[model samples]
Target: MLALPAESVSEADVIAGILALMRERTGYDFSSYRAQTIRRRIRNRMISVGIHTLTDYLVHLKSVETEALELLDRLTVKVSHFYRNAHTFDMLREEVLPGLYRRFGGPLRIWSVGCARGEEPYTLALLLEAAGIPGTVLATDIDEAALRAARRGIYLRDALRELPESLIGTGLEPVPGDERHVRVRPALRRRVHFQVHDVTGTALPLGTTDFHMISYRNVLIYLQREVQERTLLQMRAVLRDGGCLCLGEAEWPPPSVACSLSPLPQRSRLFEAIAAEPIA
Candidate 1:
């Protein structure tokens, strides 16, 4: 990949070439991402890899599987923290959990789709535990590096900045010798599972409408609108009727998705699945 005259290629041609190489060699597709973001990321990756053009980067990907995976990881990295949206988690803790507990009983199952670094799922587990509701969380992400970090179940002290002091030690315990880090309690870890999965891929991790809630915050905004619609439909199919779907604060479902879901009275980002399509 180094020998080719990468400097002469147009930026458009370079991004196209990179996209093509990803599709052909790895079967990973970035086509649904916003074009501007794609271009910026390609350029950034080029700089990181010491390459001046996407064409040379394509050649580099072909030669190094590890580097290819690293690029994929970089493109998908998410900087999420425990209880990202305080108000949303507060609502879940006070109103949503109690209602769901009355409706479905304890030991409910949750799926945190597009989970990056495990904060969302861990927060759910912590919330449920604090609320005296027993639930299991299944967190999935497309980035392997993110999943690996989630599996470690450890986080820096500042990750607690958003937390209220009263809730401390309920879900997190300080590591034996480290003052600057805390580990999600081993018991909570048992309740939250992490796996690597691409939501847009051919297969879904969930085979039925079994989940009670799917906390897929902040991820849909990265995908194109049509992809967001299709992903919502897929989510509807797998989410049990009456289940809750949590999204990032700035995101809203298209009307097509809103048709099958009802927004909670107070929360804009939280929706209840209604009259979902029956699963096969």
Candidate 2:
């Protein structure tokens, strides 16, 4: 019988080791993430540290506290902005929200999973307020630092520069005395609640809400197929019948599951839940 070649560890192993440390220390798991992208990020960290061997790098990570956290931040990929996709916002404003309003008259509930830095949930609050819809938003993320930043509800001026002039005019008011930070209006801010939550773990802190909409965009791409399926199932359980689930333009549900697809204008990926049949 031929003996198997010794398993050669590379930069990827170093990357995985660091991520595993984060999971153990912080309880935020990225173990199920796509390997290639994780490898690339780890390689970048290796170059930054000037370490060649995975074994050496693991030892280095154990010694350095701040550097390890910085690496984890880099790997988590928390890039987000207010109304990041204009077309999707437009669809929500014009089509989906109106339908939801007609169906569920007042006090609507929305969830923004993986809500990095609160932009998306705050944007939803602004939109709902502008449209004269009474709603509360539950915004959750795995990163505590990100959640804290979001809870502050302050953003740099440049972050809002690209916001639609109409939305800026109606929804947001500039922060007095601080040119750099913009505060979400009192009413809109009151409607949004931010919490730190691990998506791969148990359900969020809130109770079972009558969720008419969920914005879970750009999050599923990082998760493995099994995690994605479980997350989607949990999302479906929370969502009301005929409610909508919005994904980032680049993201899509796995082909195996069945859900109603309602393509919004300008290529917005607004999907409505298919109503279940009543028991006889």
Candidate 3:
């Protein structure tokens, strides 16, 4: 019988060691994620792989490169649907977008950060088409698999449950020879561009400065404080003056950047970027 190393090393230390190994090998850092979330995800991954002990899992993780990838994928939460939060989209369509459309003189440039499986960006695309606004959406996520699916523009029928009735037949069509799935219309797909991006990193895409709106919903709740602050600042830097920043209903900007964002009236999680002060 293999003696359990957890008998000597503390559970927290063992978990930390596993996270450090994941960071070293994958170049994706989960070290700063909420401790409980990280631990739970690690526990789930261990169970999936049939590992029974923390120390044992750490040893196995160190040996298997593929396990590292699996762990990384497990860390990303990809829960999204078309018009996931109806009220938020309702506010966007009714009040927010018209103002932006007027400000930009026609076409708008929007970015959907952490665009899981492409639902959110495609939703934005549908909104633009419905409103007769000529706009482009840049949908980015750190998960390559999610980006691939987003690019494919196909989804199962259940994914459209929250989608408004008016949008039916406008953006998505039933997949032929298959009753269970649908695909975004080609014109709608053309309006949104998908890319793989790491929000925790420093770089923003080229021409990011002119982005009129950025929807960064539901993603920040998983990050550590410092990372959340840094990521908010990055989004702030890329947002054009008076552009909108849409967050998940439960999320708020860290205190450090709160002063630079003003929430829209009667809107649950929408904020407008305050113009930066000029350096003397």
Candidate 4:
């Protein structure tokens, strides 16, 4: 068997070292993440810390306590906003929710996996409330910091600028006297539950839920092919029959899974899930 080239072997070693340290300390296993993305993130961290070599960076990572974890969180790309993608929400409002209502009864259960800072799940809650759909939004992410922010349910006023007029209802209102900060309504916030969850793992605190819909969105793009497959399988296991799975416009599922992808008219990023008949 041929050995990997010297540079390739060295990069792999760095990634392996980082994965080992992260798993041991933070329980975030980036072992199955794509190498290029991981390497880029690590390199960016190194530059930010003024470290020249991977070895030196690893040493710094070891010596630092909470800061190392913060670095990792930053690299995870947690940037998100309410109604980040407008078309997708539009489709959910016009087509998907109605389909779910016709198929299932009231009180829909939605899991927004990797819901960073509560934006996506909160957006869903707002839309559902506007549509008069009785439902609960379970928002989850691996990062505790992000989860904390999500739980606060407070966001910058500008983050909501893109929300459709229908979803926003009246114009944005201040949180009493605070002009720069805005809080989602209590009624909307009441419908959401935020928790820390690592999608790559088997033990999701959420039980075997009959989820009517799931929105993983851009989260899977950070993972490697194998990790994506494993996560998708776990998601499929929890999803109810005939329920839908929504992904980011840039993300695509493996072709082996038998399900129909129906494109919504107004939404480019949204696709509806149709169950394939069992082949006996």
Candidate 5:
């Protein structure tokens, strides 16, 4: 029997070592993530890949680049749906987009940070179509695999479960001879671009373009608090004055960032960016 070191025997110690390895190899910090969540996810990944020990897994990460990518993908959560949180989409359609449409004088540039499999951006394309507005959506995610799938623009039949029926075929095409697959239409795909990015990194590409609205919904909750704050500042930099920034309903910005934003009257999760002394 191989004897592991007494110092590395405890589960806590093992998890810490694994985390350090992850940060070192990826350069994306996750030290502030919820410990229980990361622990559970990595443990699950280990078991699935037949990695019996955390120490062994650390060794595996160094040798296998694909495993590292898979580990990163597993660590991040990517739950999204078209017209997700329908009330929120309803708010965007009824109130938010029109407000931006007037301010930007027609074509609106929107950002969907941490966009997984391109649901939100494609949804935005459909919404803009319905509203009779020209718009472009830049969708980004940290997972390269997810971004590849997003670019492919095909989804399972069940993926449209929450989307309204009338809005379905307008921006998406069902795969021929296959009932289970749907592809985002060529015209709609043209309006959205997908990119790979790690939001925790210092060099996130928000482009030089000023965005009228950003849909960063649900992604920040998984990050460490400091990361969440840094992400807010990054988004603040590219957001045009008076642009909209929508976060998950359960989320809150760091106190310093909160001062620079004003909440929408009907929705507290949504904020309108306003000028404040920039944080360095």
Candidate 6:
């Protein structure tokens, strides 16, 4: 087993080493995530593995191949609920989506980046269905396991708490003999495709200038400022002219990308791509 210096290495050094090793070994980069989020995840993983010291954790991470993947999962923890902010979905359903469909014309395409366990994409599918629009959703996440669970299309009752009542019977069906759980109806699930994608990587899913809408809510808050700016730029490049970009209520396009995006009137976190304007 390779070793990091136990006596002299500070927690920050050991954490940086762990992150670097993870990038080298697993091909996933967590180095661009905020330091505090990284530290908290590392500490959580240490507790899980019964390693109290950061130096020891680094040594253990180097020796165990599975530990790297485990730690990656910890660092990219995916926690979300269906219709996470009820008001956001309400706005999408009542205002944003219909306009996009009308403007873009048939077969509306939506991308749900960092879609976590699939709630966001499935929620979109439900909205499309309710609006009687012909559309498909592409859901992507860096975590393969999360995508696997998403493909399964199942959720517990609590996860559906914020799900609008009208959608409950239409979008989800109860699992056999499992009252506490429900699965996205097969018909609705058919409208969403899940893939493993890392936002930090160079490639953009589907290609540039493609999607009519991109819902990247809540994921940016954890990334570094540089990464956040890069991601917002990517969103700008891929979104069609006048396409909508939905962010978490607390999030906004960084100044660098703000010129390419204009906030919609009365919408909390919704922005429209100014695709034709020079982003100066």
- Top candidate on TM-score is 6
TM-score, each model?
0.89, 0.87, 0.92, 0.89, 0.88, 0.93
C-alpha displacement of 165 in model 2, angstroms? 1.1
Question: How many clashes in each structure?
Answer: 0, 0, 0, 0, 0, 0
* Candidate 5 Cα outliers beyond 4 Å, as residue runs: 1-13, 20-29, 50-53, 59-65, 206-208, 277-280
What TM-score should be assigned to candidate 3? 0.92
After superposition, which runs of candidate 3 have C-alpha atoms over 4 Å from their true positions? 1-6, 276-280
Candidate 4 residue-wise lDDT at 32:
71
CA lDDT of every candidate:
0.81, 0.77, 0.87, 0.77, 0.82, 0.87
In Å, residue 3's CA in model 3 sits off its true spot by: 13
lDDT of 6 at 39: 87
lDDT of 2: 0.77
**Tens digits of per-residue lDDT for model 6, 1-280:** 2233657767778788998999898788888889999988988998899887788898899899789889988988788988888988888899899988888886888999999999899999999988899999999999988999999989989998899889888789999999989999987888999888888777887543588999998889899999999988888888887888999988987777887788888757888888545555
Q: Residues 119-152, candidate 3: write the lDDT tens digits.
A: 9999999999888899999999988888899999
Clashing residue pairs, backbone N/CA/C < 3 A, model 5? none
Off by over 4 Å in 1: 1-10, 24-27, 63-65, 206-208, 276-280
RMSD of 6: 3.0
Clash pairs for candidate 4: none
Residue 241, model 1, lDDT: 85
